[model samples]
Target: MHLHYLGHLPPDDPLDGYLRFDIAPQLGVHRTPSGFRVFQFDFCRDVYLYEELGGAFRVVGKFFPPGRRMAPGLVRPPTETEFQNLTYLHRLGLNNGSFRITRPLGYNPWLHCVLVVDHFDGQPLGEVIHQAIRQDRRNRLFRKLSALAEFLAVLHNRTAGDWTVDFSHPYDYNGRLIESLVEKRGMARSEAEEFYHLRENWRARTCMWEDRRVLVHGDATPSNFKVGPGREVMVFDLERMAWADRVFDLGRLAGELKHFFLQETGDPWAAEPFIGHFLWEYCGYFPDRRDAFRSITRRIPYYLGITLLRIARNAWVDWNYRRRLLEEAKQNLRAIP
Candidate 1:
């Protein structure tokens, strides 16, 4: 609810800060205070503006503030790679028609932000899960899940032979993930050590499993996607996109589903059906269904563990629940088939 100004703007007109970019001139600016959010560690500020082009109201200006300084005392800012990832995924979505994503309008280097093609007009999938209407929308849920899985399969198939695997990536990424939980979220050092041990064992067990890499929507939390009429799913925030095992995305989403249900109903089992439905729908696309299912079953536990550990970094969760999540993640790691 509290606002923190990050960008250096002119005292006369804050909106004028963006109009300086040649990409498009802003005719009107409207700030959406309620829409601003913190995704992971990134502090995001949003604004809706009407562009002068064709006098049409479009362009969602997203500002990524330099929340913290990175290595070598350099400020961590939005990179062009993420912008490219957004564009790539948008084009991929348009080509397949399986899903839709916010289009990248342009990137402003000076402002440390980017303008998206549109401001999403639908409720996020996370919100949809909490709505009572979701019970009546079960069929639509399946439709959305099916479409999402198909798109993921398409992406994996298209990039199967294109990317090379880096075995050290998971270790490095997961290490940093746990460290953030411990340092920033006050996770107990003992739990952090346990997670590290689990990671070590998982690395040995999954030596060859992480070899197959695909273009992954690295941050696949429910908040990153929106659901519309007909269960149409539109994804945004591709900043964490990378070439990794597709299971990473699946596991993160599944863990989110589990976490939400556990928090809402105090029973993780309540989410099993939806998680099963998603995985089953995803496996429908594999040519060798049995083998793919086997692999997914065996390997998803590791990714789900990683996702749970990552989820523990959220400050909003109570300390007790966060400990339970860490314990659950450890159990998932130990139960890996």
Candidate 2:
């Protein structure tokens, strides 16, 4: 293999050997690579590897930050969890069809916990949203949102399981975010307390537990999904994937749409039509679409509120914007439906 570095390769990096010796066999590339290039995407964290010959292979390697553990004494690393999640979903038939995901190639714990997967050539959905807002491409945005809605609906419906929907996870998650706002972001304790009580009210709603658990993307932000030229949706970032209420994904997506519109156009209501369309499209995948729509809409507000609070925790967001998010979240939480 005539390996070339287009970006910095860390000292004593073993990635070349890992790809040549471990990943090559799985890819059926018995022949030596005539030429190869590696480009670091995010400093030392992500790299794009390309083989000019030997079938012109291309893959992205993601390196998990060291010292991060799922829990005390848990040997399972984030790399393993993500690889297993990807493999699990792939086996469930998400590797092809209209809805897809980056195919997991391999993972090397020795090489900085690098998880390798097929490199997707698609535009990030976030960028698409930006284009839609800036260029007034409402039709294009509608089509993409429909595709995403279908993708998520299929994922949740196919992965529905016997496990019960646990409200505790979301309750704790929201509480923690509020606490962080008060403790770290200088949010008033009274405001945080009010949010906490509102969250508690949501927890008491029996509608929250009506649905069976399904595998949710966990992080359904626009940046985590990509839209191909054919408008196919491919979701990634499965590190947060878990069994939860299906709306966990939908509401986060809705929250993102609302946030983008508010930030870009200074109109929160601008996203309402699209959000309605997205959720309505999602309901189409169910046997009783109307019932599904009614049930999901009833529960989506809580998750949307949670997503808003989650975004508010980000330090990069302007303090005023964060406060607005908190207020929006409060209104959603206060909804009786």
Candidate 3:
């Protein structure tokens, strides 16, 4: 991973006081940090604060892009939402365990609306997956998948609520993705229309409404999870976290597994065993494993198809590869009947 260090901030920088006064006490560091070493990552900047007394701390800060607006009338901005979500999850006993989230330190609206949280130590699961594929380490991949499945199960099961599942969001999201592909000239109008019909068909499936609403990771991409030395998983990027079908997370992960295998090994079917193992492992956490497996599998195609379309719409992906993703998405949607 490429990381660019921006060097230590000057003494007059406001972040210095924020760290010294606000964050230091929470971390039990008595003295002010001498300086902060800032490193820019793909989506956020990590600041490492060091004190003369040998106290050191790592905190991640994310800034929202200018003109980025939430849905109309939404109360909280992205930074506040993420901070609250992290705090909520931390209070739910996810602060320490095999499955946990990074601790939220504080949000600084004056500092570019930055949302800060404790830094998590581990490798992104995306890199782990790439290594497994390159090294032919199927066992290692399976173990990591198992750990992720367990973590997700605990997250969903522990936070399941009585709220009704909002199936419209997925339908609208899939439609918007198709429209974006058409606008980008990545897909033809006819292809987009056909995908729309497929989405409608998926919406009509009763299985989509069979499960209760649960707190889903909302963005279950491999890059959002960190894997420690013991295969422990720490999921972050909670800005999109919300209540939805538990399979929403699972199917996205399954689709990603398929995408990675196709991109790396040139075989779509190569991911089947790992996907099956992941879903089976997720179901193991529920009371009726057989029933849960059947229900989750039946609903997986919709979210999985949506995930494939989501990836296919990205301009960075090769055109031919995006076409393959579109075809795979169609196949999954068509298999629902």
Candidate 4:
């Protein structure tokens, strides 16, 4: 879980009132939406209390980079729209959901640099599931799983094709997006030819495109969500929202549901009984597509298997927090039929 920090390096967005440096803000004079302000609102969540006051909020404030303890290096400032888009994407959620990953609270169009979404809230589904299992209360497990399914259904229903990003070569990977997925996740590394052939072989696993496509929230991990006071699942942060494979999106949900179910039961084989029930419940919203849905179902093992492998690969990079993860990864692998 490396949060993308592309916002800190580039042209600073004067519109967003962002300044670049490793300087931690002090309770001092910094302009706000109003006027000169001594401090900003206080944030109390995720084990940290951050109040902006009396200083410039640098791009690299109170954070250490990956390999270095000193701090991230200085960089060129951000441009106008570049900065604004970052803020808009981040704060845009405020208008729609309870949270936004905007670069800065304030806007400064003059400097282009903006912030990345490092914000993680909402009890990670994993943590939430773990606590429930520890307390021997898996009653709401199905309900929560259904809730997540609904969220995915909505997102998959809206995946658009027009929207594009800079890095991705859309011209190259349109229909073959699954191939890209295979390569990106390192799931089909048997050989280059084998991976290519496998990718070419995977047909559109689902007929989710029968109705329409809007926007697919690319990443829907539990950590990306946050539960409001009443446990309302407010889906926020559309950083990866885009036109994408409908099966890919739903496949992810199936994999997650399988992981949680197997975790609670500790038996990979026990997953099948509930899986049919879950799929039935999931399709209640996006009805009349059992064939497409089941295609994704059968492939859940591939997705889940690759996902577990990725965890192992990530663990080798850093051993400090491997125990809890290693066990889960192995369990996921075992549960993958």
Report the Cα lDDT for candidate 2. Answer: 0.82
Measured against the true structure, the TM-scores of the candidates, in listed sequence, are 0.79, 0.91, 0.94, 0.51
For model 1, residues 168-287, the per-residue Cα lDDT tens digits are 677787899889997899777887888788778777775435557888888888778876776366777777777887788888888887787777777757777777888887888888
Regions more than 4 Å wrong, model 3? 43-55, 65-67, 71-74
Off by over 4 Å in 2: 1-12, 34-36, 42-55, 69-75
Please give the RMSD of candidate 1 to the true structure.
Answer: 5.6
Least well predicted 10-residue stretch by lDDT in candidate 4:
39-48
In the range 1-337, model 3's lDDT, one tens digit per residue, is 4567667767798877887789877877777777777677744343332332243777777776456776755676788889889999988897676776888889987876778777777888888788878988778888999999998988899998887677888888888888988998458888988998888888888777757899988899998898887758888888889889898899899999999999988898988999999999999998999998988888888899889998888768998899899999999988774
Model 1: per-residue Cα lDDT at residue 272: 77
Tens-digit per-residue lDDT, 43-160, candidate 4: 2111112223332332212212233332133232222223343454444343244332333333332222222222334455556556655765454555565666665654454333
**Reference-based TM-score, model 2:** 0.91
The alpha-carbon lDDT assigned to residue 251 of candidate 3 equals: 89
Per-residue alpha-carbon lDDT of candidate 2 for residues 1-337, written as tens digits (9 for 90 to 100): 1224575434355777677667766776787554456665642334456553445577777776576556644467767788999999989887777777877889878777889887767788888888888998888888999999888888898999987799888888888888888888899988988998888888888889878999999999997899886658887789779999999999999999999988888776888998999999999998999999999999989999888988888888998898788888888889957
- Cand. 4 Cα-lDDT: 0.40
Candidate 4 has a TM-score of: 0.51
Residue 308, model 3, lDDT: 93
